[model samples]
Every structure is written in structure tokens, then in C-alpha cells.
Target: MLLFSRFAPNVLLSAAVALSVILAAVMLGLAMDQRWLGLKLEAQPRLAIPASFEGLWIDAIEHDSPAAEQPGAGIPASVASLVSIGGPDQRSIQLTPQDLMEEPDALETYAGMRAFFARQDEIAGILRSIGGVELGVAFLGETQTYSVSPKHQRPVTSLPPSFWMQIGVGLAGFWLGAWIWSLRRGEWATRFLLLAGAGLMISAFPAAVYSTRELALPGRLFSVLSTFNHIGALTFGVGMIGLFLVYPRRLVSPNWLAFPAVILGAWQVVDILQLADGPGLGFHLAVVLAMLAIVVLVAIQFKVTRGHPRDRAALAWLGLAVVVGAGAFVATVIAPNVLGIGAFVSQGEAFLFFLLVYVGVALGVARYRLFQLDEWAFRILFYVVGVLLLLVLDAILIVTIVDERAPAFALSLLIVALAWLPLRDMLARLVLRRAELSRGNLFRQVMDVALTPPGRDQQARWRALLENAFRPLSVTAAADVQDPALIDDGLALAVPGAGGLPGYRLDYADGGRKLFSLRDAELAVELTTMLANALESREAYEKGVAEERERIARDIHDNIGVQLMGALHSRGLARKDMMIRETLTDLRDIINNASNPDLSFDEMLADLRSQISEHLFAAGVKMKWEVESAGPAILPLAAAHTVRSVVREAVQNALKHGQPKSIRVTVRLDEDAIALTVADDGSGFDPSSVQTGNGLANMQARVTSLGGRFNVASGVEGTRIEARFPVDIVRITQ
Candidate 1:
């Protein structure tokens, strides 16, 4: 009782300890039985005659006491059934012997069986009350006297295979039943399974003792043991019926479970009192009915539990248990005997069939989690650790003993690297259900999330990365976890905040297929570290760019703006003239693009026309400039800089080389592109024959960098250059 009641807190440890106790009990029973029958005769004297014949023919010449030292009482396989015994001159257990054929009347057909089994108890009582040195034996047509005194004493190893096998059945049932009960102590199904196990042991244990007797046990002890065996059979049926009534789906209230036990107990009473006229009503009827009931209940459970996958799986396992557990016993033992056809094996050996049931159920409950999956997967990880130790041992052995072993280390590592590593990953994915993103892929994604700039959109991108990696069913904001952790038995994983990103709680991993394991937690830690580092690096880069931009703005104020402010004191047109010139120069410097520029295309064109007019007048060259455009008003710094620099260089080239009388600069703007044409009336040279200068190369490079076109044509009339820039393409590059 202490063994059962004290150990519910630690399920696995309790099961192992209780199972060991059951094994020890069975071994002790075997030892006691082997020593109980002290028979050292050369051959066994157990007689198994056909059930049809009934007589005891004991031929004895020396009539004092049976001796192991004398001669052997060679009992043949073919012998008359033993049915009569008496006191020393008083006939006490004599019975009529005949061969009765089967008949249509069921009661008449089994009348001899009923009479023999009913009076067999009384006959055993008579034999048990025998006095010292006195016994009697008789047959139908003859008389003889005999006794069995195994005074030479049996060897310690005198037990038969039937005894060991019977003990196995009992221990198997008892241990497996205790194991299931240990795991699910509060479950009604497991409790009934435990009861079934107790019943199996009760029947098998006592049958192990008397059924393997050398010659005979005392009649009273034999009768009590036989009654105990009947009790086990009765209880076993009741447990099965009650188990099916509630398991997978409860077909009846748990309160109604006692009715089957009460009914079966009453039926056992009738069998014991010989109230039933037919012989099959004793224990076999209960067994057959329980089996039929299990079948019917399984069918009903299948229909009722249609949408429940877990319950259906349990039902399949339990139904298989019934078929394997009780089916063989009926086939070989009870069914044969009830039909007046002799049993194929001894009743003790037939108990082995009952062992199969508990083994199947134990595998279902303990190893498979009712046959769903993912238990051995956890324990096998320890085995993988042991294998790692073995690999380390191999490396150490190679270093110490082998002459040429440097290459062997590589081979060993490669073997595990290619084979064991992948297998381990596959199992981790199957059982642990961690994210399968590769390290390289995850690093790239985390970098993208970090570079998304600081705002709500950046945080959203970070959250999106987590969703893609883990594929959790639901995500919600959570209080900050200092580190990523699995909570609620892996039902939810709490991810820590990294950089500016907030913590999140992820639930029901992989569509609720599995729980998070250490593998998943380790993966989360890796991702957190990566994201933190990437975000820190992006923040540092952006900070450096801002600091540099601040210095440039300061330089503009000190070196350029101060001189222009000094000239602002002049009056009238001169003051305003100086101011406009300072503004045009500052706007060109700003187009160096330290940060994004937001200047309109009209301001850019105004600056360009001013520069052209001033530069042409200084060169003593007449100018003709016109602007015709339709496009977005604001252009980014890069696109505006390209427009400014390209036009400035083209005008300088015509003034230096073309020696033009007059220059015409034409600009046309569209939504996606800007087109410019610079042509001069001068002594033009052949463009193909002349060496290209830095100015022409720079203008062409700027135009083509924005995915536009550049062209040049030269003749005696003048030199013409056309360049076009895709303004939208320039903005996308930024």
C-alpha cells in the first residue's frame, strides 16, 4: 500500500520502483514453489489424461508408504483420468466412469462436467483429511492403494517452464498496470486498468503454485487456491467492462461503474453454489460478455469521437489490447474446456496470453503518449550526448596510439558532420519544432530589419522577421523579457527587446504541432544577439553621417556665409545684387548632397541660367539660353546636383574649346527625365578626331549614371552635345 500511495508525485521514478517490487515478488514465488515440491524422482509424475475418462488405478506391491528411493511410478501420457480416492479401508471419493458423447440438450451435454467440478471440492476435502500413513485409491472395475512421499527432497532448480511463464504473466500484468496508474493516477481509465492488472496477478499467481505441483497439494490448500483463481477471472471481466464504459468517451456515469462488479460478483456466487445447471455460466460467460461489450463500446466511441483525433487514437490502441489480451486465452483454454474438447496447453502456461495486453498498453501510454509522438525524442537526446563522448574518446585514442592519425580526426569529424548533424537537425525539426531558417538567411533578414531606419515601420519589419522564422499562431506585445524564454510548457515563447524593438509573446508554435525545446530557445538567443548587433551598427553609422553633416553646415556658415553678410551693408541695387549671388553659390554647394535636398526644379533652372549668362559674358561670348520643362517640382540632392554640374561643365567646354560667337543652351524636363542640348556657332572641330577632355567625360558620366543617354556631334558649323538624365532613377538610388 505504501508503494502505491506514497509515489504519485514523481511519475517515472515511482513506476520504475513499483515495477521492481513486482519483479522481486514474482521471483520469490518461483523459489518457494520450486522448494515446496521436494520430489527427486527421475521422471515427473504429473498425469494429464483425456477429460472423457474418469478413474484412479493405483497398483502398489509395497503398501506402507510411497518412496522416491524405491522404483519409479512411470505415469504414461495415455492413462485413465484420476477420479476416486478414500480412507484406509473406507471408500470416500468414488465416481462413475463413462465416455459421454455430445448431445442437443446443453444441460445434458455438460452434466458430467458440472457434477465433477461440483464434487471435486468435496473429494479434495476428503483427501486432505487423511491421517498419517494411511490412504486409499480406487478405479471403476478395480482397486489399488498408493501414496507419494518425496522424502529424497527436490533440487533447488526443480521448477518447470509452466511455473516461470505463469509468474511472468502475473508480473507483467501487475507492473504495467501500476506503471499506467502512476502516470495518470487521477484518470478513471487508468484506475480501471490498474484494477484489471491486479485481477490478472491474482489469477495467475495462485495457478502457478498448484497447476505445477509434482504429485499433489493438500486438498484444502488446493481448493482455496483454485477459488482465488476463479475470483481473479471474475474481477478481470468486471474491470474490462468498466474501463470501456468511460475511456476515450464516457458512455456511462462513473457512479454506474460499480453495477458491473456487483453483477459479476453475484454470478460468481451462483457458480460457487452450483445454482447454474450449465457448466459455462461460471467464469467463461462473464469473459465472453465482457469481450462483446468492449467491441460494442469501441464502435460507439468511434462514432461519438469523430472529430477528436486524440480520443480516436486511444480507442484504436485499446481495441488492439483487448484482441491480444483475452483472445488467445479463450482460444486455447476456456473455450476448448467448455466445449468438452480438451485444452491444448496446461492452464498455467495459458496465462502467458494475458501478458501481451499490459505490454501494449504500457507502450501506448508511457512511450507514445497514447501513440501521438514525441517522447523517446526527448530521452534520445541524452543518448546523443553519450555518443559525443564516444567520439571524443575516439579522437583521444587516435592522438595517443596511432602513428598517422591527423587525417583520421578529419574523417571522424566529417562523418559526424555530414551524417549525424543532419539527422539530429531533422529530429529537432520534427520533435522540437524549432524554426528552420539557416544562419546565413537569418543574418541577412536581421540586417534588413536593422537598416529599415528608426520608426514604427522599422519595428514592424522586426516583428515580421520573427513571424517568418518561427511561424507562431499568434503574436502579442509582452512585458520585456531580459532574455528569450519558453513559458507555459513551451506553449508560448517570450522574446526579449533588442535595440529599439519591443518584446513580443509568441504562442502555439508551428500551428500547435509541438512545444518549444532547448533548441528553439537557443535559436531565439542567437537571433536576439544578431538583431542587437545589427541595430547597434546601423545606429552608429547613421550617427556618424549626422555628425559629418553638422560640421559641413558649420563650415558653410563660417567660410561662405560670413563674407556674403559683410557685403550686405551696401545700398540699392549693389546690396541686392550681392545677396542673389551669395544665394546661387550656396545653393550649388548644398547640391553636394550631404543630406537629401528639397530644392524645386524652378530654383535649379534659375541658378543654371544665371551661371550661363555670367560665364559667357566673362568669356566674351554671346549667350542664348531658354528653359522649357514639365516635371516634378522638387528633386533630391543627387538629381539636382547632376543637372547643375552637367550644364556648368558643358558651358565651360564650349567657351574653352569651341571659340563660339554665340552659345545656345536648351533644357527640356519630363516626369522621369531631363534633356539638355548645348550647341555653339563657332569654328567647330571634328569630335571624333579631337582628344576628349575631363569636362566632356564628367558630363557624360553624370548623365549615364542616372540611367539616361549622352551624345556628341561636331562639324564645321558648330559642336552640339545632347545629354538626358532619368530623374526618378536618381531618386530611387538615394
Candidate 2:
């Protein structure tokens, strides 16, 4: 029900109504038949004297037969006078043997004549004397005798069961199609349903014309029905054409065709009304014009599908329907009338055209996504043929069973059952296999790898697995080598035997490899390079740890040495005991703070400053400090300590030899670089003369090794030292 509502509500309603009407019609027909049966006892054969047969032969012929002297016996002059031929108001008519010379015309006229005689046999004597065949003749003087065959039976004119069935089917089909159309709102569905309904109404018009003459409908009703039919046909044509334009797969101009379509539709309706009484030249003209429009539409459809391959299948289906429908329409209109095959055949042909059109339209609208229509068609054909074969077999079985050949029927059934399952399975498997193949091999391989577990030593394992897997493709791969080493060694070795031809190498190893022509050699080189790098890195890490430990020991011994010795010197006396204890505490604190990894570079610098100030105050050297930084002070603790040591050494040098009155230390950051300068106003010495004795060379060497610039400019006025390093370098070391 939902499906019907969704896709074809109009169709559903039409089918329902058609079914009800069919049931009513069937019941009514049955009741009529029963009533007819009940009236059989009193019923007599109905016959009529044709009004046209009055004066032709009845006037001249006499008695029931022609006389010897006359070819047709003349009517008795007295009786003819009394009869007044065809009564006073009737026009005189004549019959001649010339009219009866043609067998077909004579037979038709004779049949009418016989019907007249049967209804009024009392006047048969006059009719026989005129044109009808005589049953007997009286002899008087020169008498003649004649005989006649019994009259042909008139055919029963009631509608056949098949005719009713056809009407029902057509009504149901049209209603179903209309209901489908009605699911859509407003003009679109209404117009289509109107068109379909008009077609059905038009179809019933001929039956109504055939069935009744006295109760003929008013001319206006017929005119309106005709107009509606013409309009509906026009609407259908225009709608289909509009659909072609609006939803085309390529360029289309609906506006270009719309005005003309409307004009053509109106013109067609006028033409139909004008020609409704009989076939006219105007009807032919309208048909020609409609054909031209159909041609133009088809041409446009072809143009739309030219560049759009996606629409090709749909266009093909539509084109086929159009061709078939048009052919059928043409055949229906011309074949029976021109060839004399009768009317029902033409109607059947028209019905076929309509059916084809419905199927095509339904497929185009609802099943267009099935682009493989040809495949579907083939499958349907195959199944239909298969089913037909099964039916044939089933029929044979039934016939055989009825004839007592049970073994034959059983054998046939067995054969069919045995074949069906395997055949269906084979077809399914073939389709699936083709689909799988179309997806490509590489995708399958990737899927396989994804579904598998990672191995221990996953990197090497995966590389080896890929290499082995790809071996079937003649691809040689190295899994664990660096690129440069592959270029330097692997390529040279791999290419020597191949006369210097280069080869391609895929680099899947840790650091990858250079291209190699020979796959085997590249794999070996890659693996070797990976192992070498790994071992080298491990060794370097171990060496760095040992060096760090030694450096820490050296720093501890150097910084704390003088303070420890001073404490040891004062250990024996009570007067020096307090000094010794204080010295020991300071030394221990410095050592412990220096060893702490978590201490930030700025905190270390502050500690260093405090230690230096304590030492300087103890030594009686006045210190002036100035520090300016643009951003954070981010020097590492180790580098900060080194800077402090350098500062202390400079101050000590100034105090010991230069007799400096005031010592100054300034730290400033400029851009990313830091500059630290220590200067004193004291008796200064020439830096060239001081040489390495002043530890200037040591300070310069320490700064140079750390990628910093250190300079000591000492003259007679004062000694100045400046050291500069990158903040990034300091942080990295920390």
C-alpha cells in the first residue's frame, strides 16, 4: 500500500474503481443473461422490413415468381395500384439486375431483402416477384417455378466476454497509471491523469456508438468529449516534451519549445473537433504536424544524450518505446481500414502501443538508476525462456500423467529440479567473481595486510612480508637500509653485471634507499645500512652518558676545592671552628644545588650571583652589577654556572693584580643573543703580555668551544671582557 501510494496512487485508485466496475458489469451481464433465459419461452426472432427495399422490386413482380414472358414477373396492375407502390408519401425506388451482377454487393442487398421478408412474410409474394429469390411459382397458361434457400442467420450483436475483459483491463491500467500520476500535487499529476483518463474515455466512445442508436448522446456531449480527448493528447505530448527539455542530461531550452507546443496543442484540438464527423484532410494535417513535433523532440533527445553517456541507456529505452508506439499507432490507423482485416485487430495494435508506452515511462521514471537495462532485459529474457521451457515440460508431464505415463512425468520433473539449483548458483557466483575482479588486485592485497596481525619486530617483519609478497612481480626490495649508502655501495655492485643500466628501487626501509636496478642487491644494502645506524646511535648514547658523569665530577672538585681546603685549615682551633663550619655549609649547599637537574637556569644564575657576592665581600672587593634582558633569562644551569665561574675568575684577577677599586658586571640580551661584560677601573695590563697566565685563554677556549665569542681587551686603563652566546644553544645544552 505504501509502495502504491508512493509511486502510483492514481493507478491504485483507478485499479480499485475498475475492479468494482468490472464486478458490477459482470454481475449485471450475468443477470441480463438469466433474464434473457427466463424470457426464452415467450421470445420470438426479431426481424425488420428494411424501409429501403420498398419500391425497387415489389412494383414490377407478380405473384411469388417471374412469368415466362418477363424476366422478373410484374406486380399485378390492380394490386400495384391499390398498394400505391410505397404509399403516397414515399419516394419511388427502382432495382435493376445490373446492381446484382456484382456478387459482394448482391449478397449484401440480398441479406437485407431476406430480413425484410422474414419480418413480413405476408408481403413476401411481392418481394419475391421483385428481387428476392422465390420459393415457389404458380403455373397458368405459360407458368414458371422457382425455389429459394433458407435465409442466412443474423449474427448476435452483444459484447463478447473477451471484449468486456479488454475493457476492464484497459480501465484498470489507465486508472492505475492515473492514480500513480495523482500522487504528485497540482498541475503535473492532474494533467497526466487527465490525459490518461481522456484516453480511456475516448476508447469507450466507439463501444457506445456501436451499442446504441436511439439513445444517442447529445452532439454537445460528443463534441466536448472529442475536445477533451484532443486536449488530453496534446497535453500528454506537451508534458513529455517539456520533461525532455527540463530534465535533459545535456543542453535544452524549454522556453524555446513551450510556446510552439501550446500553439500546436490548441491547433490539434481544433482540428480534431472539425474532423470528428468523418475523416478529413484537416485530421491528416494534424497527424502530420504531431509527427513533425515528435520528430523534433526525438532529435532534441538525441542531442542531449550525445555527450552524456550516463543518459544513453535511458534515452535508448525511451527511443525504443517511441518507435514501437508510433509504429503501432500507424499500423492501427491504416492497416485494418486499408487492408480490410477488421476493427478489433486495429484496436489490439493500439492497445499494444499504449502498453509499450506505459512500460517505457514507468521504467524511465522509477528504474532509471538501473543503467544496466540491457543486462536486466537479458536476464528477464533468459528467465522467461526458462519458465516457458518449464511450463512446456509441466504441460507434457500433465499430458503424460493423464495418459498413464507416470515414469515420463517423474523423469522430467527430476531433470528440471536437478538443473535449476546449479544453474542459479553458477550465475550468482559468476556475477560476484566478476565484481571482485573489477576492484583490482592491489586493493585486495592491502585489505589482506590490514586484516593480519603485526609481527614481533614489526617494522622488519612488515618490510620482509611486503618484499616476499611482491617477489612474484619480480620486485626486489631491501627493508632496513639508508638511501645514501645504497647509492654508494648497492647500486655500484648491483649494476656492474648489468653493464651500467640503472634500476628502480622502492625505499620501504627505516631511512629508505637509493634506486637500484637489481632488486636483490638493493634489499641487502638497505638492511645493512639500517643495522649500522642503529648500532652507531646506541654506542654514541653510551659514550655521552660516561662523558657527562666525568664532567660533573670535575665541576664538583674544581668549584668546591678552595673552600674545602680553607675549612680543613681551620678545623683544629675553637676560634676558627665557626668559620670552618660556615665554609663547609656553603660548600655543601653549592654542590647540592649544582647537582640538581630541576633547577632552572635563572635560579642557578641567582645562586651563582649570591655565591660570588659572598666570596667578593669576604675578599673585600666591591662589586657593581647591572643586568637588562628583553625577555626571560633562559640560560641553562650548566652554562649559567660557567658564566659565573668566568665572572669570578675575572674579579679575582682584577683583585689580585690590577688593584681594582670597583668591579662591574653587566648582563644584557640583544635579539636572540646574550652579552655579558665585566669591567674594572684598576691598574690594567696588556692582554698580549698577560698571555694564558690570566686564564683569559681558558675562558676564550671555553666560550669558543660552546659556539660563543669571548674577548679580553686589557690596556693600562682597565681590563674589559665580553662574552656572547646564542640563547638557543644555551637552552639546548640545558
lDDT at 526, model 2: 48
Instruction: Pull out the clashing pairs in model 1.
Output: none
Candidates' C-alpha lDDT: 0.63, 0.45
The local lDDT score (0 to 100) that residue 228 gets in candidate 1 is 70
Output the worst ten-in-a-row residue range by lDDT, candidate 1: 97-106
Clashes of each: 0, 19
Leading candidate by TM-score? 1
At residue 184, what lDDT does model 1 achieve?
A: 61
lDDT of 2: 0.45
- Tens digit per residue, CA lDDT, model 2, 1-734: 34554544434444445454554354334222210100010011122542222121222222232221234553233121111112122222232222211111112232332332232332222332333333222123222323222122211233334344434434543543454344443333334333544454344333322222111122333334334444544454554444444433423443464564666666665555543332222233344455456567667777767755335546666556655764465455533333334333424335445556555654543333222222233243234334434655766776655454566566666766788647755664453221222224433433343333334343343344345422322334433322423332221222110111112243322222211223335444443344345445545766776866665565546445644665567545652554454456546645664565334555655765776676567657788887776544456544565576677667767877788777899877565666789998888886667656345765676567668899888877788999987655433222
Model 1 residue 137 CA deviation in Å: 16
